[model samples]
Each structure stands twice: as structure tokens, then as C-alpha cells.
Target: MATRFLIEGRVQGVGYRNWLQEEARRRGLRGTVRNLSDGRVEAVIIGSYEETDAMLAACRKGPPLAKVSGIGLDPIDDPDVSGFIVLRDY
Candidate 1:
């Protein structure tokens, strides 16, 4: 399964992408994470339902520097990536 997460609040410039990369990879998920122009962080995660849900929970809290106010989630087609990565800003 695959999912997209739009993470809001103090996400940019706070190592959110890198943090997500670590979290996703650690959970054996494959996909990408990037910064959005509108001050949010976007992550595309591909994994089992359990892994994806775990990642979402982690994202809600985010890194210590991130003050995540919320996260918007949507189901998406899997990108078929091999490993988790952090993408450049959009």
C-alpha cells in the first residue's frame, strides 16, 4: 500500500524530511519526502498497512525541532521505490 502525508506546522527548515526518511526507512518503507512551497512537508510512503500507520503516528509528533500541528493523509498509488529518500523542495 501507499500513502501521502501533508504535515503542517513548523515543518520546513526543521529537518523534517531527513527525520521522515529515517523513520520510513527504519520501518522498511519505500518512498520520498520533500518540503512543500506552502510551509508543509510532504511524504509519500509505501509499505504494509501496519508500517504506513506507524509512520503516520511518528509524523504526528515529528522531530524535536518540528512543531507539527496536523497531518493530512491520502491513499495513493505506490511509487515502487526501493528505499526511502528525501527529495528536494518543491
Candidate 2:
């Protein structure tokens, strides 16, 4: 299973997606992170419960450049996602 996260606040242009991808990969998590049209960053991380929880915690603080205001999470149905990547903005 995957968890989709919508991160709000000062996300764009701050290397948020790149930071997220690096973190996910470092934790052996599989997923993709992208910038949303609404100026938020969105990520779908597929990994174990523990890894997922840790990723969410890091997202709250984001990169040193980001001022994360909020992060909303939703359980996803995808179970085949592989590798971490920084995707183009939506």
C-alpha cells in the first residue's frame, strides 16, 4: 500500500520534492514526489508502516528551506510502485 501526502506552505522552489525523493530512497521506500499546481508538494510513498511514519515526520519539517504549514495524508491503493523519483510539477 501507499500513502499519498499533500504538503502545504512554502514548498515550491525550495527543493522539497528533491529532498523528499532523497529521504524516501535513503529509507528504502518507493515512491514519487511532485509539485502540485496549487503550490503544494505531493508525494505517494510506498513502504512499510514504520518507514512511512518516519517519512511523514520528516515532511513536517521539510528541507531547511521549506516552511511546511501542513501535511495531509491519505491511504492509497497502489502496491506496485517502485523506486523513488522527483517528478515534474503537475
Candidate 3:
């Protein structure tokens, strides 16, 4: 199973995406992180349930510069990500 998340609040321009990419890679997760024009960071991480949960916990705190307000999580039917990458703004 894959886990997708939409992280809201003080996410963009704060290295949140970059940090998420690194963290996901470190956890050996296949996923992508991107910045939304609505000032949210969206990510899809695919890994074991435990690893995905850990990633979500980390997203809740984010990087030092990030002020994460909320994290919305959902199970994805198909998250066909190859590897962790930082995607262009959507």
C-alpha cells in the first residue's frame, strides 16, 4: 500500500520539500514531494506502513524553518513513484 499526504501551512520556500525528499530517501521510500500554489506541500510516499507513519510524523514537524500546521493523510490506490524527488510547483 502507498500513503499520500497533503501538508498545509508555512511549507513552501522553507526547504520543506527538500527536507522531505532527503528524509524519504533515507527511509528508502519511493515518493515525490511538491509545492502547491496554495502554500501547501504535497507528497506521496510508498513504503512499509511503519515507515510511512514515521514519515508523516516527521512531516508534522518539518524542517527548522517550516511551521507545519496540519497534515492530511490518505491511502493511495496507486502511488507509482520511482524514487524520492522534488517536483516543480503545482
Model 1, global lDDT: 0.90
lDDT of the candidates, in the order given: 0.90, 0.90, 0.88
Per-residue lDDT tens digits of candidate 2, residues 37-66? Answer: 999999999988988999999999989999
RMSD of each: 0.7, 1.0, 0.9
Q: Against the true structure, candidate 3 has what lDDT? A: 0.88
Candidate 1 lDDT tens digits, 1-90: 989999999999888898889888778889999998999989999988988888889999999999999999999987878898888889
lDDT of 3 by residue, 1-90 (tens): 687799998998888998999999998999888888888888998888889889889999999999988988888876666888888888
Off by over 4 Å in 1: none
- Model 3 clash pairs are none
Clashing pairs in 1: none
Off by over 4 Å in 2: none
lDDT of 2 at 77: 89
